[model samples]
Target chain A: EDQVTQSPEALRLQEGESSSLNCSYTVSGLRGLFWYRQDPGKGPEFLFTLYSAGEEKEKERLKATLTKKESFLHITAPKPEDSATYLCAVQAGGSGTYKYIFGTGTRLKVLA
Target chain B: NAGVTQTPKFRILKIGQSMTLQCTQDMNHNYMYWYRQDPGMGLKLIYYSVGAGITDKGEVPNGYNVSRSTTEDFPLRLELAAPSQTSVYFCASRRGGTTDTQYFGPGTRLTVL
Candidate 1:
Protein backbone atom coordinates (compact mmCIF):
# COMPACT_ATOMS: atom_id res chain seq x y z
CA GLU A 1 0.00 0.00 0.00
CA ASP A 2 1.17 3.51 -0.68
CA GLN A 3 1.29 5.72 2.40
CA VAL A 4 2.69 9.05 3.46
CA THR A 5 3.46 9.99 7.04
CA GLN A 6 4.37 13.37 8.44
CA SER A 7 5.97 13.65 11.86
CA PRO A 8 5.65 16.20 14.67
CA GLU A 9 1.90 16.57 14.32
CA ALA A 10 2.17 20.02 15.79
CA LEU A 11 5.04 22.34 16.57
CA ARG A 12 5.30 25.62 18.41
CA LEU A 13 8.43 27.71 17.87
CA GLN A 14 9.59 31.09 19.02
CA GLU A 15 9.96 33.59 16.21
CA GLY A 16 13.30 33.37 14.39
CA GLU A 17 13.72 29.74 15.48
CA SER A 18 14.68 27.13 12.93
CA SER A 19 13.24 23.63 12.56
CA SER A 20 12.52 20.88 10.07
CA LEU A 21 9.34 18.91 9.28
CA ASN A 22 9.58 15.36 8.03
CA CYS A 23 7.57 13.43 5.43
CA SER A 24 8.24 9.77 4.82
CA TYR A 25 6.58 7.57 2.24
CA THR A 26 6.21 3.96 1.18
CA VAL A 27 5.04 3.46 -2.38
CA SER A 28 5.40 1.19 -5.36
CA GLY A 29 7.25 3.78 -7.42
CA LEU A 30 7.96 7.38 -6.58
CA ARG A 31 6.93 9.91 -9.19
CA GLY A 32 6.83 13.21 -7.36
CA LEU A 33 6.74 14.73 -3.89
CA PHE A 34 4.95 17.99 -3.17
CA TRP A 35 4.91 20.49 -0.32
CA TYR A 36 2.10 22.93 0.42
CA ARG A 37 1.32 25.55 3.04
CA GLN A 38 -2.22 26.00 4.28
CA ASP A 39 -3.45 28.81 6.48
CA PRO A 40 -6.44 28.72 8.81
CA GLY A 41 -9.78 28.48 7.03
CA LYS A 42 -8.09 28.78 3.66
CA GLY A 43 -7.00 26.49 0.88
CA PRO A 44 -3.49 25.20 0.50
CA GLU A 45 -0.83 27.09 -1.44
CA PHE A 46 1.87 25.31 -3.43
CA LEU A 47 5.37 25.52 -2.00
CA PHE A 48 7.75 23.10 -3.68
CA THR A 49 7.99 19.87 -5.64
CA LEU A 50 10.86 17.44 -5.30
CA TYR A 51 11.08 14.92 -8.13
CA SER A 52 14.05 12.75 -7.19
CA ALA A 53 16.40 11.81 -4.44
CA GLY A 54 19.03 14.47 -3.74
CA GLU A 55 16.75 17.07 -5.32
CA GLU A 56 16.30 20.33 -3.40
CA LYS A 57 14.25 23.47 -3.90
CA GLU A 58 14.15 26.76 -2.02
CA LYS A 59 12.01 29.84 -1.80
CA GLU A 60 12.60 32.81 0.42
CA ARG A 61 13.18 31.31 3.90
CA LEU A 62 12.03 27.76 3.10
CA LYS A 63 14.05 24.90 1.66
CA ALA A 64 12.94 21.37 0.77
CA THR A 65 15.17 18.36 0.27
CA LEU A 66 14.28 14.87 -0.85
CA THR A 67 15.67 11.39 -0.29
CA LYS A 68 14.79 7.90 -1.43
CA LYS A 69 12.30 7.29 1.37
CA GLU A 70 11.57 10.71 2.80
CA SER A 71 11.54 14.48 2.36
CA PHE A 72 12.37 17.35 4.68
CA LEU A 73 11.01 20.88 4.76
CA HIS A 74 13.52 23.10 6.53
CA ILE A 75 12.53 26.49 7.78
CA THR A 76 15.31 29.02 8.21
CA ALA A 77 14.79 31.52 11.02
CA PRO A 78 11.06 31.33 10.52
CA LYS A 79 8.91 34.33 11.25
CA PRO A 80 5.37 34.44 12.56
CA GLU A 81 4.07 34.82 9.03
CA ASP A 82 5.66 31.51 8.16
CA SER A 83 3.29 29.72 10.51
CA ALA A 84 0.92 27.35 8.74
CA THR A 85 0.13 23.69 8.32
CA TYR A 86 2.66 22.17 5.98
CA LEU A 87 1.35 19.32 3.82
CA CYS A 88 3.22 16.57 2.02
CA ALA A 89 1.89 14.52 -0.88
CA VAL A 90 3.36 11.86 -3.11
CA GLN A 91 2.41 10.73 -6.59
CA ALA A 92 3.00 7.11 -7.35
CA GLY A 93 4.27 6.11 -10.78
CA GLY A 94 2.28 2.94 -11.48
CA SER A 95 -1.13 4.31 -10.50
CA GLY A 96 -2.40 5.12 -14.05
CA THR A 97 -4.24 8.01 -12.44
CA TYR A 98 -2.65 11.15 -11.11
CA LYS A 99 -3.82 10.40 -7.59
CA TYR A 100 -1.72 11.59 -4.70
CA ILE A 101 -1.18 10.10 -1.27
CA PHE A 102 -1.05 12.82 1.35
CA GLY A 103 0.21 12.99 4.89
CA THR A 104 -1.95 14.37 7.69
CA GLY A 105 0.35 17.39 7.78
CA THR A 106 2.45 19.22 10.40
CA ARG A 107 0.87 22.17 12.12
CA LEU A 108 3.45 24.88 12.76
CA LYS A 109 2.99 27.90 14.94
CA VAL A 110 5.66 30.54 15.31
CA LEU A 111 5.08 32.84 18.25
CA ALA A 112 6.42 36.34 18.20
CA ASN B 1 -6.54 35.42 -13.40
CA ALA B 2 -9.13 34.03 -11.00
CA GLY B 3 -7.04 30.88 -10.70
CA VAL B 4 -9.34 28.26 -9.17
CA THR B 5 -12.64 29.37 -7.58
CA GLN B 6 -15.34 27.50 -5.69
CA THR B 7 -18.80 28.82 -4.91
CA PRO B 8 -20.76 28.71 -1.61
CA LYS B 9 -17.79 29.40 0.61
CA PHE B 10 -19.90 27.95 3.43
CA ARG B 11 -23.04 25.80 3.50
CA ILE B 12 -25.15 23.74 5.84
CA LEU B 13 -27.18 20.77 4.66
CA LYS B 14 -29.55 18.52 6.53
CA ILE B 15 -29.32 14.77 6.33
CA GLY B 16 -30.56 13.26 3.07
CA GLN B 17 -30.33 16.57 1.27
CA SER B 18 -28.24 17.15 -1.81
CA MET B 19 -26.03 19.95 -3.07
CA THR B 20 -23.53 20.73 -5.75
CA LEU B 21 -20.26 22.51 -5.08
CA GLN B 22 -19.22 24.61 -8.04
CA CYS B 23 -15.63 25.06 -9.15
CA THR B 24 -14.18 27.00 -12.04
CA GLN B 25 -10.71 27.93 -13.17
CA ASP B 26 -9.63 30.67 -15.53
CA MET B 27 -6.11 29.53 -16.11
CA ASN B 28 -7.22 27.19 -18.94
CA HIS B 29 -5.97 24.26 -16.95
CA ASN B 30 -6.50 20.82 -18.41
CA TYR B 31 -6.94 19.05 -15.11
CA MET B 32 -9.31 19.67 -12.18
CA TYR B 33 -9.79 17.89 -8.87
CA TRP B 34 -12.00 17.77 -5.79
CA TYR B 35 -10.83 16.99 -2.29
CA ARG B 36 -12.24 16.95 1.23
CA GLN B 37 -10.35 17.93 4.35
CA ASP B 38 -11.39 16.80 7.79
CA PRO B 39 -10.22 18.41 10.97
CA GLY B 40 -6.61 17.48 11.62
CA MET B 41 -6.49 15.26 8.54
CA GLY B 42 -4.92 15.60 5.15
CA LEU B 43 -7.07 16.36 2.16
CA LYS B 44 -8.63 13.26 0.59
CA LEU B 45 -9.18 13.13 -3.13
CA ILE B 46 -12.85 12.84 -4.03
CA TYR B 47 -12.72 12.97 -7.80
CA TYR B 48 -10.80 14.40 -10.74
CA SER B 49 -11.21 15.25 -14.38
CA VAL B 50 -8.46 15.36 -16.92
CA GLY B 51 -10.48 17.22 -19.49
CA ALA B 52 -13.98 17.75 -20.80
CA GLY B 53 -16.06 14.57 -20.78
CA ILE B 54 -13.42 12.72 -18.84
CA THR B 55 -13.76 12.05 -15.12
CA ASP B 56 -12.34 9.52 -12.71
CA LYS B 57 -12.38 8.51 -9.05
CA GLY B 58 -9.67 9.17 -6.53
CA GLU B 59 -8.78 7.87 -3.07
CA VAL B 60 -12.21 8.71 -1.64
CA PRO B 61 -15.02 8.74 -4.14
CA ASN B 62 -17.98 7.29 -2.29
CA GLY B 63 -20.99 9.54 -1.78
CA TYR B 64 -19.61 12.00 -4.28
CA ASN B 65 -19.85 12.49 -8.05
CA VAL B 66 -18.25 14.89 -10.48
CA SER B 67 -18.65 15.97 -14.07
CA ARG B 68 -16.49 17.85 -16.51
CA SER B 69 -18.50 19.21 -19.37
CA THR B 70 -16.05 21.96 -20.17
CA THR B 71 -12.42 22.67 -19.65
CA GLU B 72 -13.05 25.56 -17.29
CA ASP B 73 -15.44 23.97 -14.81
CA PHE B 74 -15.62 20.91 -12.61
CA PRO B 75 -18.33 20.53 -10.00
CA LEU B 76 -18.72 18.03 -7.18
CA ARG B 77 -22.15 16.64 -6.37
CA LEU B 78 -23.22 15.10 -3.11
CA GLU B 79 -26.38 13.09 -3.67
CA LEU B 80 -27.26 12.55 -0.02
CA ALA B 81 -25.54 14.59 2.60
CA ALA B 82 -24.50 12.79 5.75
CA PRO B 83 -22.81 13.78 8.98
CA SER B 84 -19.68 12.00 7.81
CA GLN B 85 -19.68 14.19 4.74
CA THR B 86 -19.20 17.36 6.70
CA SER B 87 -15.84 18.74 5.69
CA VAL B 88 -13.97 21.50 3.97
CA TYR B 89 -14.05 20.93 0.23
CA PHE B 90 -11.28 22.26 -1.95
CA CYS B 91 -11.02 22.48 -5.71
CA ALA B 92 -7.71 22.60 -7.52
CA SER B 93 -6.40 22.66 -11.07
CA ARG B 94 -3.19 22.45 -13.04
CA ARG B 95 -1.90 22.33 -16.54
CA GLY B 96 -1.82 18.70 -17.64
CA GLY B 97 1.55 17.37 -16.56
CA THR B 98 3.06 15.15 -13.91
CA THR B 99 5.20 17.93 -12.46
CA ASP B 100 2.74 20.78 -12.62
CA THR B 101 1.87 22.28 -9.27
CA GLN B 102 -1.84 22.46 -8.43
CA TYR B 103 -3.55 25.75 -7.77
CA PHE B 104 -6.29 25.60 -5.14
CA GLY B 105 -9.38 27.69 -4.60
CA PRO B 106 -10.58 29.31 -1.36
CA GLY B 107 -12.40 26.05 -0.38
CA THR B 108 -15.96 25.52 0.79
CA ARG B 109 -16.82 24.62 4.37
CA LEU B 110 -19.79 22.22 4.45
CA THR B 111 -21.62 21.09 7.51
CA VAL B 112 -24.25 18.36 7.76
CA LEU B 113 -26.80 17.92 10.49
Candidate 2:
Protein backbone atom coordinates (compact mmCIF):
# COMPACT_ATOMS: atom_id res chain seq x y z
CA GLU A 1 0.00 0.00 0.00
CA ASP A 2 1.14 3.52 -0.72
CA GLN A 3 1.20 5.73 2.32
CA VAL A 4 2.79 8.93 3.64
CA THR A 5 3.81 9.75 7.17
CA GLN A 6 4.95 13.11 8.49
CA SER A 7 6.81 13.26 11.75
CA PRO A 8 6.83 15.80 14.57
CA GLU A 9 3.06 16.22 14.43
CA ALA A 10 3.51 19.67 15.91
CA LEU A 11 6.54 21.87 16.46
CA ARG A 12 7.08 25.15 18.24
CA LEU A 13 10.15 27.07 17.20
CA GLN A 14 11.43 30.34 18.51
CA GLU A 15 11.88 32.96 15.86
CA GLY A 16 15.22 32.58 14.08
CA GLU A 17 15.35 28.91 15.00
CA SER A 18 16.10 26.32 12.37
CA SER A 19 14.52 22.92 12.21
CA SER A 20 13.56 20.15 9.83
CA LEU A 21 10.32 18.23 9.19
CA ASN A 22 10.30 14.68 7.95
CA CYS A 23 8.04 12.96 5.44
CA SER A 24 8.51 9.25 4.97
CA TYR A 25 6.66 7.23 2.37
CA THR A 26 6.19 3.72 1.05
CA VAL A 27 5.06 3.61 -2.55
CA SER A 28 5.16 1.13 -5.40
CA GLY A 29 7.10 3.55 -7.53
CA LEU A 30 8.04 7.11 -6.73
CA ARG A 31 6.78 9.65 -9.21
CA GLY A 32 6.72 12.95 -7.39
CA LEU A 33 6.87 14.40 -3.90
CA PHE A 34 5.19 17.70 -3.08
CA TRP A 35 5.29 20.17 -0.20
CA TYR A 36 2.57 22.65 0.70
CA ARG A 37 2.05 25.31 3.32
CA GLN A 38 -1.45 25.81 4.65
CA ASP A 39 -2.47 28.68 6.87
CA PRO A 40 -5.48 28.77 9.12
CA GLY A 41 -8.76 29.16 7.23
CA LYS A 42 -7.02 28.97 3.88
CA GLY A 43 -6.24 26.41 1.25
CA PRO A 44 -2.77 24.93 0.90
CA GLU A 45 -0.21 26.82 -1.08
CA PHE A 46 2.31 24.98 -3.18
CA LEU A 47 5.86 25.13 -1.88
CA PHE A 48 8.09 22.64 -3.70
CA THR A 49 8.12 19.44 -5.71
CA LEU A 50 10.81 16.78 -5.69
CA TYR A 51 10.79 14.43 -8.63
CA SER A 52 13.66 12.13 -7.83
CA ALA A 53 16.01 11.10 -5.11
CA GLY A 54 18.97 13.41 -4.44
CA GLU A 55 16.89 16.32 -5.70
CA GLU A 56 16.60 19.54 -3.73
CA LYS A 57 14.66 22.77 -4.08
CA GLU A 58 14.68 25.99 -2.13
CA LYS A 59 12.71 29.18 -1.71
CA GLU A 60 13.87 31.95 0.55
CA ARG A 61 14.19 30.46 4.04
CA LEU A 62 12.81 27.04 3.08
CA LYS A 63 14.65 24.16 1.47
CA ALA A 64 13.39 20.71 0.56
CA THR A 65 15.51 17.65 -0.07
CA LEU A 66 14.41 14.23 -1.24
CA THR A 67 15.77 10.76 -0.70
CA LYS A 68 14.84 7.25 -1.71
CA LYS A 69 12.44 6.68 1.18
CA GLU A 70 11.86 10.10 2.65
CA SER A 71 11.98 13.86 2.25
CA PHE A 72 13.01 16.67 4.53
CA LEU A 73 11.80 20.27 4.71
CA HIS A 74 14.45 22.38 6.34
CA ILE A 75 13.53 25.79 7.60
CA THR A 76 16.47 28.16 8.03
CA ALA A 77 16.01 30.85 10.60
CA PRO A 78 12.26 30.73 10.31
CA LYS A 79 10.13 33.73 11.17
CA PRO A 80 6.71 33.99 12.71
CA GLU A 81 5.17 34.42 9.29
CA ASP A 82 6.56 31.01 8.41
CA SER A 83 4.25 29.41 10.95
CA ALA A 84 1.79 27.10 9.23
CA THR A 85 0.98 23.47 8.68
CA TYR A 86 3.33 21.83 6.20
CA LEU A 87 1.89 19.06 4.10
CA CYS A 88 3.61 16.28 2.19
CA ALA A 89 2.17 14.30 -0.69
CA VAL A 90 3.44 11.63 -2.98
CA GLN A 91 2.21 10.54 -6.41
CA ALA A 92 3.07 6.97 -7.15
CA GLY A 93 4.03 5.65 -10.53
CA GLY A 94 2.90 2.32 -12.11
CA SER A 95 -0.68 2.98 -10.96
CA GLY A 96 -1.71 4.60 -14.24
CA THR A 97 -3.96 6.76 -12.11
CA TYR A 98 -3.80 10.31 -10.82
CA LYS A 99 -3.86 10.26 -7.07
CA TYR A 100 -1.69 11.85 -4.44
CA ILE A 101 -1.28 10.17 -1.06
CA PHE A 102 -0.90 12.83 1.60
CA GLY A 103 0.37 12.94 5.16
CA THR A 104 -1.53 14.40 8.10
CA GLY A 105 0.83 17.38 8.01
CA THR A 106 3.18 18.96 10.53
CA ARG A 107 1.87 21.96 12.41
CA LEU A 108 4.66 24.50 12.84
CA LYS A 109 4.63 27.51 15.09
CA VAL A 110 7.42 30.04 14.93
CA LEU A 111 6.92 32.26 17.93
CA ALA A 112 8.36 35.74 17.92
CA ASN B 1 -5.60 35.45 -13.31
CA ALA B 2 -7.69 34.00 -10.55
CA GLY B 3 -5.89 30.67 -10.14
CA VAL B 4 -8.81 28.88 -8.54
CA THR B 5 -12.03 30.05 -6.85
CA GLN B 6 -14.78 28.38 -4.82
CA THR B 7 -18.19 29.80 -3.94
CA PRO B 8 -19.77 30.10 -0.48
CA LYS B 9 -16.62 30.56 1.62
CA PHE B 10 -18.62 29.11 4.49
CA ARG B 11 -21.94 27.25 4.79
CA ILE B 12 -24.25 25.57 7.25
CA LEU B 13 -26.47 22.71 6.16
CA LYS B 14 -28.99 20.52 7.91
CA ILE B 15 -28.93 16.78 7.81
CA GLY B 16 -30.42 15.41 4.58
CA GLN B 17 -30.20 18.81 2.96
CA SER B 18 -28.36 19.21 -0.33
CA MET B 19 -26.01 21.83 -1.67
CA THR B 20 -23.57 22.27 -4.51
CA LEU B 21 -20.06 23.65 -4.01
CA GLN B 22 -18.95 25.56 -7.06
CA CYS B 23 -15.32 25.64 -8.23
CA THR B 24 -13.92 27.64 -11.07
CA GLN B 25 -10.42 28.20 -12.39
CA ASP B 26 -9.35 30.81 -14.88
CA MET B 27 -5.98 29.16 -15.51
CA ASN B 28 -7.55 26.95 -18.21
CA HIS B 29 -6.33 23.84 -16.49
CA ASN B 30 -7.57 20.57 -17.93
CA TYR B 31 -7.41 18.72 -14.63
CA MET B 32 -9.44 19.70 -11.57
CA TYR B 33 -10.08 18.05 -8.22
CA TRP B 34 -12.13 18.30 -5.03
CA TYR B 35 -10.85 17.35 -1.61
CA ARG B 36 -11.96 17.57 2.00
CA GLN B 37 -9.73 18.31 5.00
CA ASP B 38 -10.59 17.37 8.54
CA PRO B 39 -8.87 18.06 11.82
CA GLY B 40 -5.67 16.07 12.25
CA MET B 41 -6.22 14.30 8.95
CA GLY B 42 -4.70 14.56 5.54
CA LEU B 43 -6.70 15.99 2.68
CA LYS B 44 -8.94 13.32 1.21
CA LEU B 45 -9.79 13.38 -2.43
CA ILE B 46 -13.51 13.34 -3.12
CA TYR B 47 -13.64 13.59 -6.92
CA TYR B 48 -11.64 14.67 -9.93
CA SER B 49 -12.04 15.48 -13.60
CA VAL B 50 -9.53 15.00 -16.37
CA GLY B 51 -11.45 17.20 -18.73
CA ALA B 52 -14.85 18.55 -19.50
CA GLY B 53 -17.53 15.84 -19.36
CA ILE B 54 -15.17 13.41 -17.67
CA THR B 55 -15.26 12.69 -13.95
CA ASP B 56 -14.14 9.99 -11.58
CA LYS B 57 -14.36 9.11 -7.91
CA GLY B 58 -11.50 9.51 -5.47
CA GLU B 59 -10.68 7.97 -2.12
CA VAL B 60 -13.66 9.54 -0.33
CA PRO B 61 -16.33 10.09 -2.96
CA ASN B 62 -19.31 8.74 -1.08
CA GLY B 63 -22.22 11.15 -0.61
CA TYR B 64 -20.66 13.54 -3.10
CA ASN B 65 -21.08 14.00 -6.85
CA VAL B 66 -19.25 16.21 -9.31
CA SER B 67 -19.81 17.49 -12.83
CA ARG B 68 -17.47 19.09 -15.31
CA SER B 69 -19.57 20.73 -17.99
CA THR B 70 -16.76 23.05 -19.03
CA THR B 71 -13.04 23.16 -18.57
CA GLU B 72 -13.21 26.12 -16.24
CA ASP B 73 -15.97 24.95 -13.93
CA PHE B 74 -16.38 21.87 -11.75
CA PRO B 75 -19.02 21.73 -9.07
CA LEU B 76 -19.37 19.22 -6.25
CA ARG B 77 -22.88 18.25 -5.17
CA LEU B 78 -23.67 16.84 -1.80
CA GLU B 79 -26.75 14.65 -2.08
CA LEU B 80 -27.47 14.52 1.64
CA ALA B 81 -25.45 16.36 4.24
CA ALA B 82 -24.07 14.44 7.20
CA PRO B 83 -22.16 15.48 10.27
CA SER B 84 -19.22 13.38 9.10
CA GLN B 85 -19.20 15.44 5.93
CA THR B 86 -18.60 18.69 7.71
CA SER B 87 -15.14 19.76 6.62
CA VAL B 88 -13.08 22.29 4.74
CA TYR B 89 -13.56 21.52 1.06
CA PHE B 90 -10.81 22.61 -1.29
CA CYS B 91 -10.70 22.86 -5.06
CA ALA B 92 -7.49 22.45 -7.00
CA SER B 93 -6.34 22.49 -10.60
CA ARG B 94 -3.26 21.82 -12.65
CA ARG B 95 -2.19 21.92 -16.25
CA GLY B 96 -1.98 18.64 -18.12
CA GLY B 97 1.09 16.85 -16.84
CA THR B 98 1.88 13.97 -14.57
CA THR B 99 4.18 16.00 -12.36
CA ASP B 100 2.63 19.45 -12.36
CA THR B 101 1.87 21.24 -9.12
CA GLN B 102 -1.78 21.74 -8.25
CA TYR B 103 -3.03 25.20 -7.41
CA PHE B 104 -5.74 25.40 -4.75
CA GLY B 105 -8.59 27.75 -3.98
CA PRO B 106 -9.29 29.44 -0.67
CA GLY B 107 -11.52 26.52 0.40
CA THR B 108 -15.08 26.33 1.75
CA ARG B 109 -15.85 25.59 5.37
CA LEU B 110 -19.04 23.51 5.57
CA THR B 111 -20.77 22.70 8.81
CA VAL B 112 -23.52 20.14 9.24
CA LEU B 113 -26.15 20.33 11.91
Best by TM-score: 2
Candidate 1, residue A36: lDDT = 97
| Candidate 1 local lDDT, B6-59, one digit each (tens) | 999999999999999999999999989999999878999999988899999887
User: Candidate 1 lDDT, tens digit per residue, A1-111?
Assistant: 899999999999999999999999998788889999999999999999999999999999999999999999999999999989999999886544577788999999999
DockQ of each: 0.75, 0.82
Give the lowest summed-lDDT range of ten residues in model 1 chain B: B94-103
Residue B4's lDDT in candidate 2: 98
Q: Give the TM-score comparing model 2 with the true structure, all chains together.
A: 0.98
Reference interface contacts recovered per candidate = 0.69, 0.78
The chain B TM-scores of all candidates, as shown, are 0.98, 0.98
Clashing pairs in 1: none
Please state the interface RMSD for every predicted structure, separated by commas. 1.2, 0.9
DockQ for model 1 equals 0.75
Two-chain complex of model 2, DockQ on C-alpha atoms against the true structure: 0.82
